[model samples]
Target: MGQRLGVDVIYTGPSTADASEQVRILEDMISRGVSAIAVAPNDAAAVTPVLIKARNAGIAVLDWDTPADESVVDYSVQQVDSTVYARHMYDLLVQNMGESGDYAVVTGGLSAENLNIWIDEGLEYAKVKYPGLTLVTQRIPSDEKQQLAYQKTLDLLKAYPNLKGILGYSTPAPIGVAQAVQEKGLQSRIAVVGVALPTDSGPYLEDGSLDVATLWDPGKLGALTVYVASELLNGRAIADGQDVPGVGRITVRGKVIVMGPPSDFTKENYKDYTF
Candidate 1:
């Protein structure tokens, strides 16, 4: 996608346990003449200085999926704003749960800013819109393994016998949660919803184990970053509402650019989407 957009992209790779190694790798990408870079920083704040150095070297920086220091990056592209996605998830859960039930949230990690913001938004909306609903627990399972999410779901089920809904933000958690629900024969009693790929959650949706999965074309987002970086490198200013060729039209509000809608994949429309 980057090459198609006429820009060269270099991966800074995943964040490591060692902060110095992370910085060294990013600086090396800049030294190698990478004009523009896009990254989903594992540590939101820790990657800021390297991005700052890149900016000092006249490189255009773009942050995606994960946020970086706003002052260091030229722009940030995300699937959607945290609060917007959260409310969307809340609405879906309410629709499936009939507006009232004991619910639980499965998040990526408690320390991850993006996941926490989404959870906060969901909590606020649920409090205001579904006062009858009670959130029994919010689980942050070890996102590294699929089994952790499955095990966490089982623990949640045992802890909250009245649980009627689950909203998961992690990629694997929703799928594993669905499996646990099906195994426990609680599919009819509890509904699940979250961000997931269609293929990953297809069987569950088809069998009515999972309610819905919110998604968007991630490759499109990556492609957009490259195109935008190319535009920046060419010294063209992108106005708030300017339309990019492959990224659809965009509207910049504050520091965040809304990429597109949360493509809700379910039994009805799952087959229509390829990604």
Candidate 2:
């Protein structure tokens, strides 16, 4: 897609959520004469200087999925907001858990801003609305491991014997937590919810170990990001509530793109989704 748009995409491979690495990738991509760069920033603040340099070099820089620096970025595209998604996740968990019980949250990485935002939003939402719901623990797995999430859930269950629900921030986190609940023979008491791919979560849901997971249309997110980048490259001033071609209608609020609603997955409708 970058090549089709006359831009070369320099994939920096799978690196840690480190800012220096992000900067290095941007510098390398820019030095190669890439007219525009779309980045999924690992560290939001660490990559700011290099992104600033790329902007100064007349290269358009856009942040996709995660925003590095709103001031320096021409635009930031997201599939959904953390708070909105978190509220939805919390509501589902609370409703399933009878809206009052001990709960815990498992996260992908402590330093990943995007995941952290979702965790924060979910935690805050739970605290405000479900005052009786106590947070048993907040665990962030090393290397984004499902096994680690499982272990953390087990530990939380033992430490807080009243734990009734578990909320995860990413695809793997929830799946891992559900697997742990099943293994510990606590699935009957504990409910699991998070952002998980439907195919990967189908078995868990079928077994009644998981309740709800959120999914988004990646094709739509990618297409919209590409379209918005093209428009910004053409020197169009983006305003709030502008429509992008393939992504649907979007509104720009602050640094976020606000790409509309997220799709939910449950046992009743899980078969209808594949990704």
Candidate 3:
């Protein structure tokens, strides 16, 4: 998309969950005098000041996937409304678990704004809509790693043998949880649901280890980020309900731009998508 827009784009990400590395990368981008930057922050607070510096340097800052501090960025692009999406995921888990047992959440990391918000809203939703379900643990960090999540899930299973379901807020958590469940021959006992690429979760879904995986097109997200950055760079106004290339029509609320609905991958449909 940047190539089509005639804009030079450079992509960089921290090797681990290090906020300081993200800050350093932003500083490097500022020093290089890039015209625009689109980022999914690892830690919103830690990256805010550097984002401000980038904006002050006359560069357009676009926040994608995860939002940074709103005051420092021109716009935020998200997959869907966080509360709504969380409730939907929780509802699916409750349905699979028969709506009356203990469940737990595995999160990407505690500092991840979007994942934290999703888990919080899902917990709130469960309290109101599915009162019979009990949350077994507070949010547990997975470091966004499948292996770590797998280990943590095994520990949870050993600690709570009656665990009915597991909700994963990160992409890898559900896959890891499913693996743990499958290894223990408990697929029929514990349900797993989360945000995952179909390619990564297909085998688990097919074997009845995973219940559901939900996500938007990440390729579309990357394209939309570049498209929106180009629009801002060319002095184009982004209004509510404006059609963004590859993302469909998006709604602008405050400085946030929401991409359309999320798609769910089930056992029957997981084979259709590669990501």
Candidate 4:
């Protein structure tokens, strides 16, 4: 999208998903006088001060994937509607759990704004929509690591013998949950569902450990983010329900542009997606 727009795009990020690294990178970008900046923040709060600095410098700053302070960024882009995505995960869990049962949640990080939005939305929706479903404990934080998620799942298994479902809020969280379920041979007993990459989730999907892995196409999401940034840079307003190349229609509400809903990658179709 950047190439098509004839805009110079230089992609750089933290070597690890660390908030301090992201702040340093943003400082470098601001110093370089970049025309526009879009970030999928690792920790929204940690980067807000830097983003405010960017805004003051007359550099267009936007949030993609994860949101920062609303006052800082020009506009925000979301790959999917948070409410819809969260409810969908809950619906998947209830459907696969054979009615409704005790379920737990695992998240990437407590500081991730996007993850919390989904988890909070799902919790609210569950109380009204599926009253029979019970959350066994408070949501566990995995630090966005598969190994940590794996160990957390193991501990949950030992603590709650009747854990019927697990809703993983991060990419690595679901894969790790599925791994523990597979190892325990509890596929039929526990329903594992969450957001994850199809490439990384294929084996779990093939087995019965992971009932459903849901997410939007990151390639399309990246293109949409770049397109949105380019449009903002050109003094063009992103109209609601605007048709975008490669990404279809986008819904714009206030300063937020939502791409669409998520895609559920299951054992039957995980092979079709390469990323």
Candidate 5:
């Protein structure tokens, strides 16, 4: 996508979700005088000042996936409305669980702003919409690691033997939970729903371990981010309902960009999406 737009997008960050490393990376980008910097902050507050520094250096600062402080950030390219998406996860959970039963949440961690938004919204939405649903414990942090999530799911099963549904909030969380369920032959006993890539979540979906995995295309998101940044750099407005190729049409809200709807990958449709 960056190549198509003639934009040299340099993708680099801390390998281990480190905030200090993120700051160091941005500082280097600032030193190199890059035209734009798109960050999915590991820590929004920890990364905000550096983003502001980039902005003051006459570089475009955009946040993708996770958001940065809105006051200084130029644009937030989001995949979908967090509230709606969160509720949709619960909706999937309810459908798979049949009657409401004990369920729990496994998240990437407490740091990411986007994860918090989804979890908070989902928890509140679940209380009102599915009154029969019961959350067994506080949302557990998986540290965005599949092995950790798998370990956590095992613990969840031990803690709540009657657990009927599991809502995984991170890309790896559901896969990890699904693995544990699959190994335990609990597919029929437990319904797992989570945010994961189609390619990564396909096997679990096929085996009925993961009931549904939901997410938007990262390829399209990257393209849209570069496209938006390019427009701003070239002094063009990002019009509402703008048709962004590969990402479909987008809706602009002030400094925010919504990249159409999210895709829910089930066993039947998982093969339809390549990325």
Candidate 6:
């Protein structure tokens, strides 16, 4: 999309999980005088000022995957509505766990606004729709690391032997949860579900450790981000239900662009996808 739009796309990210580094990178991008900037923030609050600076400099700022401060970015590109995605995840967990049991959430981190939104929505939906199900613990932070999530899941299992389900909000979290369940020989007793890359979760899905996973196409999201940035740069207004190439018709609400539907991957079809 960048090539088609005759724009140079410069992609960069922090080498580690440092929001300061991410801020530095964005500041550098701003210095480069780019036409636009698209980012998935590590720390939404910390990056807001830099994003605001970019916007002030006449750069189109777009948020994707996870949103930064709404006041800084022109719009956000989301995989799906947070409420809908959360309910879908919760429904899948409840279905696999026989609709009633103790469950816990494993998130990327407490600072991830998008993950927190999903967890909050899932909790709310569970309270109303699945009253028999109980959330046994508060959100467990995984730090977006598989090893940490594995250790955390182990601790949760040891703390609550009767834990029946785990809802993971990050890709690494679910895979780690599945590993812990498998290691404990609790696959038959516990169910794990989350947003995971099929390539990462395929083996677990096949072995019955991970019951299901859901995600949208990241490639399409990247292309769509560039397309939207180009549109904004060219002074084009984004209308609701506008058809975006590569991504289907999108819904514009406030400053957010709902990308499209998310797909569920199970053992039966996970093999068909590589990313």
Collision pairs in model 3: none
Q: What lDDT tens digits, residue by residue, belong to model 6 across residues 108-212?
A: 878888999899988888889999998899899988898899999999999999999999987889999999988988888999999899999988998899999
lDDT for every model?
A: 0.79, 0.77, 0.88, 0.92, 0.90, 0.89
Per-residue alpha-carbon lDDT of candidate 3 for residues 1-275, written as tens digits (9 for 90 to 100): 87888978797889887889989998998999999988898899999888888888899998999988888889898878887898989888977888798988888878999998888888888888899998888877888888888999999999998999999877888888888988998999899998899999988998888989899989888888888899999999888999876678998898888887889999999788877
Model 1 residue 90 CA deviation in Å: 0.2
All candidates' TM-scores? 0.91, 0.88, 0.98, 0.97, 0.97, 0.97
How would you encode candidate 5's per-residue C-alpha lDDT over 96-206 as one tens digit per residue?
A: 996578999999968989999998898898888888998999999988899999998998999899999999987989999999999889999999999999999988999
Per-residue CA lDDT of model 1 for 1-275, tens digit only, reads: 67666555665564433445656778888889788877676566778888888888887888887677788888887778677788999899988887877888886655456677788878888889889888886456545345777898899999889899998876777888888998998888998998788888889998878999997788778777777678778887667777777778776876677787778999888888777
Error of 5 at 134 (Å): 0.9
- Give the C-alpha miss distance for residue 16 in model 5, angstroms: 1.6
Per-residue C-alpha lDDT of model 2 across residues 1-275, encoded as one tens digit per residue:
45556643454534554567667767888888777787877677777788889889998888887666678887788878767876888888877887787887788767677787777777777777878888765555534677877788777778888788888876788888889888887778988888888888898888778888887877678777776777677777666787766667887876678788899888899899767
1 or 4: which has the higher lDDT?
Answer: 4
Error of 5 at 158 (Å): 0.6
For every model shown, the clashing-pair count is 0, 0, 0, 0, 0, 0
**Per-residue error (Å), model 3, residue 119:** 0.8
List of clashing residue pairs for candidate 6:
none
In model 2, what lDDT does residue 58 have?
Answer: 91
Residue 254, model 4: lDDT of 91
